[model samples]
Target: MGDGSLRRIAALARQDARLLARDPAPLIVRTLMPLLVMGFTQPLFRAALRAGDVPDANGAEQGVPGMAVVFLFLLVNVVGFAMFREHGWHTWDRLRAGPARSFELVAGHVLVALAAALAQLAVVLGVGGALSGLRVRGSWPALAVVGVPLALCVVMAGMALVALCRSISQLTVAANLLALLLAGLGGALTPLSVLPDWARPLAPGVPSYWAMRGFSTVVLDGGGVVDVLLPAAVLCGFAAGLTVVTLVFFRSAHPKLTWS
Candidate 1:
């Protein structure tokens, strides 16, 4: 990329960060909402597990681990909030018309989203440790290795949505609906084993499923770095595929129009 292009991308990132910081609602929803949900739901989920309404594979030990997956799914949805906000302000259109390349613009947003995801992940992990006594048997390095790329995939998925959405209202509705659906199907709301057999094959296709599986393996199951490889690869593929599809859609939508 040229120096001008690089600078434009940096400027776009700075602009996005400033805009996000200025909006208290988006900030709260993106950062604090997940933590709030985790705080409130943890008790109920624990109660459910104890009541035998929800079977625990590892007895009470699964509570915190299970909640970890929930927290991660929340983080993924939160990180996608920027796309909705950008659509509202038409900032994406403006940025695309500027010196920044599509990749650079996408990259900048992904970085911001990654940072938000990591920050929320830290809060969730800390709360799990303090309140629920969740354990992390895997190396911190391995956790970070899996986490960073997952965040990137999530952000790229958000950008793809932004490119495809026709309006802010549509974007908001779609993002929330997609988040809820993915969370439910990906074992964030319930364990994969509890899902019907027909739904089993579809789980691997959803990015959240791969993410929750990878995270649970490393953090809860004490799996090694190699164990996370498949899920991580799936996430990477999702990111790449979504990026290409979004670019194509964006280009086609923004094509020059002919006037009579």
Candidate 2:
């Protein structure tokens, strides 16, 4: 809360940003792959939506948002690995010994992750509109209602994984599994109505489901902020819960091995 804390957080954020800039493969892959997937799968989504009674659907309505959610979740690697690499390079201890408090360190890294997630989301949406014929039928504010919380949830989920996993391999496995599970189960891969009966019921429990719901309401249904309120709130709840888990479980003293 003090100036000193703010300074520390800013400094830490700058360092992490520099590192990310130096090695940008994760960001590029996460963003580019989704666009490629959307390109190849748009026709498929269009047909599927038509079969489901959305006669006007252009596939971008489904494909664009779906790919955004899936790949945004996959960006978890950007957050989880950033922390793991700090330990891998034997810099975590040095960081801990510095003047920055634990909260400041985490906050700084989180700021960077949050910015990256939002920027990626914006790029995907912009490019989606240009390349895939995606358009927002609803309010742009409503879109942010869905996107901001979704990004926060993803960042917290990544932090939670780092807090819980003991080694680099464990973090890698858990992060990947969580991303895929959340995406698939949340209807990012397909509409919830089309998912298996058992999976449909569980869709509400995952953040991506709400994200997709909000996107559908906005991009497909032409809904406004009021329509997306529930999905945004649910995403915020998930982010808050994950944040608590990360704060409680994360420790400077925890031994995070670089490898299995």
Candidate 3:
């Protein structure tokens, strides 16, 4: 990237971070709710571990990663709502009045969303370790194998959806439904092994599924960094595709929107 582009992205990302910092709602909702769910699901995870001779199994492994995945979907709203937020606040036109390119602006928001995802995942996983005795049986580098690519995919996919939404209510309904649906279908709500025979085939379509698998390998199967390379590559591919879609959708919609 050119220095000019880098400067634009950095400046805009700083602005986004400031704005998001002012609102604790996203942090509270995404962070607290998942922790609560993780705590609530501890027993089931314990039972599942106990019922089987699953190697290196623990409650946190069974629960924390899935909870983290589920909340990743819910947390995407912070990124998906970027454009609609300006519209609601009556600042869209003013933002468009700025000299920055639309790509720069959009890229900044995506970076912010990625930041949120990374923080949420780390925090959730950290708490799981601290409070729930979550263990990392594999290389720490393998953790990033899942987390980084998953964050990018989630944010890019969210930005793509943002282009389709005209208002917060529309985005809210769409995000909530999509998040819940993906969580359920991607094996975040439950392990794919336990799902019905027919449903397992569909899990591969979602990035979260690969993310869950990557985490599971490291946390449950005592996998090395190489073990998760495929899942991480798959997630990076999803992020790339989603990035293309996001840019195409935003470019197509920008001219018609009041903000762009």
Candidate 4:
């Protein structure tokens, strides 16, 4: 809040952005990998559709949105991994030792993750537009409003993971496992309608599900801006709650640095 804190946050953001730009692997994986998967899987799903295997409702209409959700998951995972690596290598310690506060650290990492998420979103949208001929039917501004909070949720989730993890390997394994589970439950790999009745209740609990539904409703379902309000609010709450939890976890883990 103070000028010093604001300057520190700005510095950290600039440093993180430079590091992210220098490393192209995570960028490629986060932005392009999902597009590739969608490209390859579209034909398989189409064939399944023709053969009456995957069901018609689970075809392009549902699949495209679901794939976009998966791409978002990839973006979250990449950011999580990058954060884990930086924390493991003591980069976070160095930053904290500098002018950066805990909030600044979180903000900087979230900013970097947001950049990656936006790039990933653009790639998915481009690919979906070109290949699947997908179109956004609702208001673009509303979609953008919904997307910003969702990306923050993802970044906070990554921070929570970094705070909870003791080692890089553990962080990597946990991140991947959680990403896979959330993606599956959130209709990334399959449509929510195709899920069992008992599983219906669980979808709303996963962050990715809200993100996917919010985006699809605004972009593909021609829904009103009000329709996305609940999901966007939920994602914002998720981000805020997880941020508090991450801060507490970090404080507990590094008691010596509590006042640093």
Among these predicted structures, which one has the highest lDDT?
2
Top-down lDDT ranking: 2, 3, 4, 1
lDDT string for model 3 (1-260, tens) is 79988898898889888988898687768887888888888777777766665645567877888898888888767776666677667676676777667788788788877888898888888876678888888877898778999888888878877777665666677888888878877778776567568778888998888988998899878898899999999999999998888777775235223332
Residue-pair clashes per candidate, as listed?
A: 0, 0, 0, 0
Task: State each model's C-alpha RMSD to the native.
Answer: 4.9, 1.2, 2.6, 4.3
List runs of model 3 lying over 4 Å from the truth.
Answer: 52-56, 252-260
Per residue, candidate 2 scores C-alpha lDDT tens digits across 1-260 of 99999999999999999998999888988888888999888998888898896888888988988999999998887799899888888899999999988788889899999999998898887787679988778987898889999999999999999899998788778878998999899988987667888898889889999999999999888999999999999999999999999999999888898862
- Candidate 2 RMSD computed on C-alpha atoms after optimal superposition onto the true structure: 1.2
Q: Residue by residue across 1-260, what tens digits does model 1's lDDT show?
A: 78887787778678777866776474455445455555666666565445654444233234443454455554544454565555445565676666667677666777677676666666555665566555566765666666666666766666676677655555556767777778777867765556678878888888878877876677656788888888888888988898897787754224221111
Off-target runs (Cα >4 Å) in candidate 4 are: 43-58, 87-92, 252-260
Error of 1 at 148 (Å): 1.5
Where does the lowest 10-residue lDDT sum fall in candidate 3? 251-260
Give lDDT for model 3. 0.79
Instruction: Name the candidate that leads on TM-score.
Output: 2
Candidate 3 residue 48 C-alpha distance from true site, Å: 2.8
Better of 2 and 4 by lDDT: 2
Q: Which consecutive 10 residues in model 2 have the weakest lDDT in total?
A: 251-260
lDDT of 4 at 140: 68
TM for candidate 2 is: 0.97
